[model samples]
Target: MLSQLQKKLLNDFQQDFPLSPAPYADIAKTLGVSEQEVLSALQELKQLDFISRIGPVFPPNSLGNSMLVAMSVPEEQLQTVAEIINQFQEVNHNYHRENRFNLWFVLIGNNQNHLHAVISEIESETGFPAMRLPMIANYFINLGFELDWND
Candidate 1:
């Protein structure tokens, strides 16, 4: 169950995240809570997987390139493969799926070449071929949710 504070924190400030000297503190004041309270709630939300991350959402084509890459991994080797994939700073998101390309991740870079290099490195380092699925078109959506989870 989501706490009132957690729900508020997730829905109220999805976008226009604080870009000030003390962003979390700013949110604390706005939410009538202490800085530590806001920080704690945010941390809890992340730990609970209610949110992937609380960070900047860069404009597509502005921060180089990104792709939805996936690779097949034997069940016994999934953890090891995931660990190697997570080592790259370019990897913003990684997850396990129930498909042949079971280990999935999103890779971001400053350019197409840089993006490919990261992919190449992952393949070389992990010895698993990654299928790159770059976006041909994107329809922007409000990723934020307005939940009615009774607290």
Candidate 2:
């Protein structure tokens, strides 16, 4: 069951999250709760699988260099390769797709050179060549949506 505080937290702050040093504290102030309460609720939400992550979404190519990489890993080695790829902090997230390029992920770095070096390292470590699909056009996708607590 979800508490009213948790419902409000989920419904209220999808966009325009605080960017200050004490973001949670700022949220607490806005919600009229203690900072610790907000943090504990978020942790509980994660443990209950209500939320996967809490972070900012930046515009493409606005912060730093990034690339979309795909790999065709053998079905038997899919999980293992995904684990190895996750070991890199540069990797944002990876998912398995139904296409021939079964595994895809986004890698971010300080510059193009850094991005290439990380890609090289990933290719070497996984023993599979990565197909780099650089961004040719920018598209805005709004990731935030209202959660239906009634569901």
Candidate 3:
């Protein structure tokens, strides 16, 4: 279970992680806590596996091109296909969505051609066609959800 302070800190931190050389210091000032405390809280959260990462969410065009791809992987070959897709440097996230296209992943590349090449390679290696869904535009919405620590 998280202490009240820790919970408050987490709730606030999600909205904005400081963009300073010393982000902890900035967060500390805002939360009325010491910089060490901020760092310690984040470390503790990581230890508990409540937070997977504490980093920036880069804008798509700022870095490279990316697409959401789904593939219909056989149950027996799911692991193999996942491993093959994960080997690509452009693939950032992969998961098993609940649908016909069970294996889903994100492919990010230096350019559109690079993204296409990576997808083609995965298809050739896995013998599964990847359905690509590229985001044309994004509408910002807060994706925050409350965690039930008590449960």
Winning model by TM-score: 3
lDDT of 2 by residue, 45-142 (tens): 98998887788777878898889999999999999999999999999989999999999999988888898999999999999999998898887677
- Over 4 Å off in model 3, which ranges? 20-23, 141-151
Instruction: Indicate whether candidate 2 or candidate 3 has the larger TM-score.
Output: 3
Q: What range of 10 consecutive residues in model 3 has the weakest lDDT sum?
A: 142-151
**lDDT of each prediction vs. the true structure?**
0.88, 0.91, 0.84
Best by lDDT: 2
For all predicted structures, in order, the TM-scores are: 0.66, 0.69, 0.82
Clashes (backbone N, CA, C under 3 Å), per candidate, total: 1, 0, 0
- What is the TM-score of candidate 3? 0.82
Deviation from native of the Cα of residue 28 in model 2, angstroms: 8.0
Candidate 3 lDDT, 38-67, residue by residue in tens: 888888988998787887667775698889
- CA displacement after TM-score superposition, residue 96 of candidate 2 (Å): 2.0
